[model samples]
Target: MKINHVAGARRLAIPLAIAALTLGACGGSSDGGGDSSDSSSDPSKFSINLDDCNDPDSATAPIKGTFDVGYSAPLSGPVAGAVELATAGYDARIAAENAKGGIDGVKVKVTYKDDAFQPDKAKANGTEFIESQKVDALATFGTGPLSAMVDDQNAACTPMLYPSSSTDAYVDVKQFPWTTTILPLAKNEAKFLVNLIKDRFPDGAKIGIAENQTASGKVQSEAFQAAAKAADLKITEVASDADPVAAATTLKAKGVEVVYHGGVTGTCGAFDTARGRIGYEPKLVLKPSNCVNAVEYVAAGKAADGVELGAFGKDPNAPENKDDAGVKEYLAQMKEAGVPDDVIGNAVAVSGWTQADLLINTLKQAASSDDGLTRLSVMEAAREQDYASPMLINGIKWFSQPDLLTGIDGFRPIKWNAADKRFVPAGDVISIRP
Candidate 1:
């Protein structure tokens, strides 16, 4: 789990030296804006017209020292508890990177604000981040909040990296090129679930889903319906907040052989508990990737046993992954960063760490590129990344191509072992094509 500081230092230094040599050979400008004949290989290919979006005081110069980032999230609202765990991971990862001398010697400084999960507040936060705070980039949590401020971020021509949600808004490069998220698309998750059902029940089986009521939930529900239709599987839908016992009884009477809960952690827990109380046990129970939090299972108590979920990263607290190098490093870093011992292994915390890791890696790539760490270069690096993230599940690589902008390739199916209070790998990693 220990980092090789000397090797880490060398890794950062070598990239800069090579970039410098490459730039010199190509007769590029020191600011990395020189004209080049090969547009395809040009680092500035993704650079937007700053004049179109810039204000009187917009910062457009290439980063030479400190990398300033602005972050906003729901710090005191309904989702604050989950957001706080993510913040812990983000802060810990930043601390770990700074201890390693930062990305190519440029220390990262993040200014955080509480948007309280309100869209208007999120938009206002983005304005402050770009104008008042004068940060080079912006980051935030939640789909609705990020969606609320994306237009503003694009108008300001600022890079917004590693948002914590998987909404399709972040992947539309033609629309919001300044933003990208590390999370797998919710549609992709739906498709994977459909394929899983097809495999297990080749002859077809009755299915029911406890669906969320939010806008994002509607999108997810649509995806599921589309996938189910394509697979020729019948599925019944129920509102997530419906009386769980009543919902379970109705679905059971209808002979629902499988149940997929498409709500957040709380709803999932309540549904599972109600199903147990009503003595209704479907052949299989499925929860969305976002519900992989330990709190969900704890809330469901023994009812959560045998529940399955799609996960993109390893849970640090899972006994099977206790010896994993990535998990170990995360535990050490969280401990070092002063995260409480009990909260270190929370899946939400791990997700936050993963987001920070993605940003840190993207920053390094930008710094080493001929574009040399401008806001545009950071976005370019994020959109073109093609490497295995050490913090993710083994064998699941991060990739972004001209055609595929979401980056994540797939997810591993993990089953909740309530007896052990941990998630264990239940099946081989499932791949999803965009």
Candidate 2:
């Protein structure tokens, strides 16, 4: 899971000094806002004016000009893997926008700060981006990185979109006015799996869930519990453990029929260990980002065959998904940029492409100021655009359905193959009602 960003981490200290507070100039522009004659080859073709597009409940009109976009990422730290995904997304966006001659002819600049996944650092970074950077809006933000300000974003009226990690705090649409998620929540994902299992594997409808004793595990537990109740399916004991092996041992003793284990692909063998011990097995439905890298997880000898995972988009290497617009471009760029195939599969690029496209839509409707960009204008511009994210192989749409402010509410059922060591589409997308 090495993100490969240590080449020049020494320079981060300088930016760290300049970006001490959350406010400053990062010099960027509104994305995808210029001549239609440029590189249309990129699948994310963003039009200049959004007049033809449908904008439902466009809260206000857009104000364009030197719009500021603030970013808070790991930039340099231990939790660098998560930040690496976020960085890749941010880079793709800035590159795309710069290629388009800048948003609304005014180039977008991002003020990025490094908090290394530390809350105090995150708070300082947020303040630096807002006060010093004077950003009119935000894009590709991390839910886990700056999670504390969930309430602050609502109070400030600063709209934001996520690259990954959709915490429950932001999922409640009513509580947060400015934040939106691009991934399906745990509850939505579990609900989709429950219904899919009922239709696909109805014969043995028992659920055995083993959750990791982590923040992620708790979130997953909430979703699985709710889904089990809704489907009227019986959920076996909820075992909490940091040791996957122990969890497997417990499940084996329970004679579990269906198992939902909460852990990364690198460590899902607990299910197999339990199967070996009990000499019995059941189907599995993991988190959306749970078992993405087939070559990594399956190659490690995990029993991936017939196991289902919830996530957006399909593997780029998968022949069926290669022809797709988003999939093809992401794979190509990742390779050209020297990013490994395994990292590309992280869905970081997809997160960027989705938000970058939406931001272009926002810029087209921005209201320009007499001298520069303003919060009122940016917010208004955001309201004028109709967000239409690219369709993922999974049942989820990158953008919300009816409500423009909502987050990504769709997911796909991916089946893992022990033989091929990859995830294949099990069924259609499960769309969650917001």
lDDT by residue for model 1 (19-74), tens: 22232322223454544432223442222234456661243357867889999888
Which 10-residue window in model 1 sums to the lowest lDDT?
A: 8-17
TM-score of each: 0.85, 0.70
lDDT of 2 by residue, 17-96 (tens): 11122111211123433532321211222112222112211213343455567766566654455456646655665566
- What is candidate 2's TM-score against the reference? 0.70
RMSD of each: 7.9, 13.6
lDDT of residue 355 for candidate 2: 54
Ten-residue segment with the worst summed lDDT in candidate 2?
5-14
Prediction 1 global C-alpha lDDT: 0.73
Per-candidate clashes come to 0, 38
lDDT of each: 0.73, 0.53
| Model 2, CA-based lDDT | 0.53
